[model samples]
Target: MEKDLAPKYLIHKDEKLYFAFAVIVSIIGYLFLIVSIVGFIVWLGFAILSMFLYGLMMAQIRVNGIRLSDKQFPEVFEKVRELCERMEIRVVPDIYVIESGGALNAFASRFFRKNMVVLYSDVFDLINSADDGELSFIIAHELAHIKRNHISKQLFILPAMWIPFLSEAYSRGCEYTCDRMAAYYTNNAEASMNGLTMLGIGKSLFKKVNRREYLLQSSQEKGFFPWLAEKISTHPPLPKRIDEIQMFVGDSSSSAFRRTSRAMWLVVGIVLVIFTFAGIGFLYSDEIEEAVNSIVLDANSITNDVSSDEDSTIMVQAVAEGDIAKVKEQLESGIDPDIQDADGWTPLMWAAQDNNVDLIQLFIEAGADLELQDYYEETALMKAASQDHVEAIALLIEAGADPNMASESYGWTPLMTAATSGNLEAARMLLEAGANPKSKDGDNFTAFLHAKKEGYKEIADLIKQYEDNVN
Candidate 1:
């Protein structure tokens, strides 16, 4: 039998173009930096800051997160080693998982010669809930970033970061390249899509989300705001990301083609406009400098006279305090119920975290978004479960909350939380409301496993019974 050739999903055209654009812009930035000794000093400061920050993060991950090794997280360690061999990565990067609270994200970084990958605990848990292939796609994605030496490349282009849209475009291109590499390494397009979908919605709900309809939603996001948002974003939107993966697999008939094509033209148009402005600025340097100085002065004058609104802060505080009257007043005054505080926590989240069932009801009645995640990607139900707030959990479910909804960061449904905390009543309530007992967390531990591990015999027995009944 003849040997089969591996499928080749090469570097995307946009990736190449954007990278070239970034290099050119970086060269120009370097030229500008060399024009003045102060500019060179500023560039040096930025480089030092970058190195220091990465080093600090590396230290934090080592100290606080679990390091993958032969004994600890052995399965993931094996995957990492296998991926490195397949990708031909010489120096296997150190991988660590830190407590992310509820944030579901991962990143690969380098401090001088030391390359490391930091996986958020919740994001790492995807390995258990989804197929290991999905986790492999994610790992390969990060490894692809390291293998491509993207961090070092960006370090050289540090000066280009000052360029408004150009740097963002280049960063987005790098992301697409890494995504392609991840998909190629895993050789599973659907797994890759599911991984990205998990990042967007979380683990439990991702399966229920229609991938085709989700991609179509991107087409409806037209006009300047959406276009400008994409142009200045560090990563392409999730739908576009899925499209890029599809393109790699030679599936070009979908609407992703149209959206991606539009995005490419938008990038080209923006780049042209940026270069034209740069040309004008160079041709009329003195006039541009004068206008910039005037604008800065005006901005300072306006800043000094503006007073900040404290109403949102007060509203959030009232919700946290469970002051029904104050909450009612705020709602009556037409304050947005969905407004997030500084930490991306809405008033409803505050109420849920506080386990105030009545306050939750009030917020719901006032049109609060039940599914809103805080900075940690924790829904209200997750928070309630974490605290064993039975009444709150019952109320949330009665109000149409999905019992199977999992946090994107932790991959734990309410049932898992109840099991971990040994809250038997809460676990029973969740089971009765249709929560999946077999649902796993980021670590792949199901509610049953959590119950067993925690010595909650009753809960474990209940879960076993539930599984048996389902079977």
Candidate 2:
């Protein structure tokens, strides 16, 4: 909401311009969404699939990487905490060091609200070197990117990335910004330069290279292609990066970065990407057409319907229709009282959901498992409470059903479910049956809090009374 504490010199010169264009591109996307719903749907589906694959990749890294903590890499862990305090970042992200075979690099990643930082094993070795500040510089650079929320911003600016050199241009500017913060926080221009050098060359000789001589040779190179190559790269060239840090800390006299018009290349790149996708679409025209037609014919169509097995199906139908005799017949015929459907729904769940107390008792007498959860981990007790089925709720509770059972998805206990519907009877029964009034759901809302939200003061007061006594 307010301006940040960081000084202006820490920001790249052209970062705001590129970010404004990113905002405009997002606006254009919204316009397209309004005029083209089908296109938006396709884009959304592709985005979801891509995110799922990305999550799996991150999970694999987490499983294989060694996490830095108090007991593991304690020095690095302490340094990171100190840096976070300097940056005013309250929550420190999970940091992991992975074996990258021989790669010397680090990166920031995220999924949902959780942030992660990964430092390669080779880069992690720099802590033991004379240029140990190089490791801190790299760590600070990655932390700066996380503080700026760059990965989430990438998703917001995704539409603009298709414009050929635009992605690289923005990325290079981001590198400049992050580099500035890293230098400012680490306060070691030489270590930062050496760190950038290690990225380009290898670990063995980066410490041996002369910084003055390398920058002089890089400065002497004069050609349009060299400038163009720098422009087209997602990261500024290593020498250019090193020079920028020198200028930042008042150790250099020249600007190491410049930007020129990329309009022609932008047009060319957009045309190429469109044609590439168009060609692939042509080759798979039939299959793609069928998929589109099916979606267009039924916009509500999402998941395929899964049918239940025969015994479960009959029991569920009998419960739905209040056919207790048929349910009894099935129970007497040696059917498993707890038989579940393809979706993991059981007969007791169906009976409780419909407030069919007779069938609930019949199933319980026939050895039904009251705690069996459905595909979403919803128990019969939760189902009964959600629908305000008082008789069914009492019957299940008397049969030793857990009054505090919560659903898998929302973490809502049976009392919270009952409070949401303003069912005082169900709430009273649940509370009297020993349901905890202090338990919170996924949104951090307790039954009392939920009752207060829906203007159910009676339920709220009742829950508050129990909450006070319990506390």
The prediction achieving the highest TM-score against the true structure is: 2
lDDT of 2 by residue, 1-471 (tens): 121335445767545445544445555676787789898898889889999999998998899999999999898899999988887766677899999899989999975446789999999997787767899999999998887667766776677776667677778878988998887787777788889988978888988888878877787777978767876888988888898777767787766444355344455344454434444444554454345345432431222122224455677788789998888887787767787776787889988989988888988998888888888888898888888889999999999999887877888788988898899989999999999999988999999999999999999999999999996
lDDT of each: 0.76, 0.78
List residue ranges in candidate 1 displaced over 4 A: 1-9, 257-471
Candidate topping lDDT: 2
TM-score per candidate: 0.54, 0.58
Backbone clashes, each candidate? 3, 0
Report clash pairs, candidate 2: none
Off by over 4 Å in 2: 1-8, 222-225, 255-471
- Candidate 1 per-residue C-alpha lDDT over 1-471 given as tens digits, one digit per residue, 9 for 90 to 100: 121334223455555555555555666778887898998997788878977886886777778788899999998999899999988885577798889888878899864345688888888887676467778888899999887667766765576666677678778877888888888776778888888998899867877898888887886788888988988799989988997787667665655435345235444444664454444444554353344345543653344222112445778879877789999998897777877665777787778778888899998888777787777777788778877788888888889888898888788687887888888888888899998877878898888998899999999999889987774
CA error at residue 76 for candidate 2, angstroms: 0.5
Score candidate 2 by lDDT.
0.78
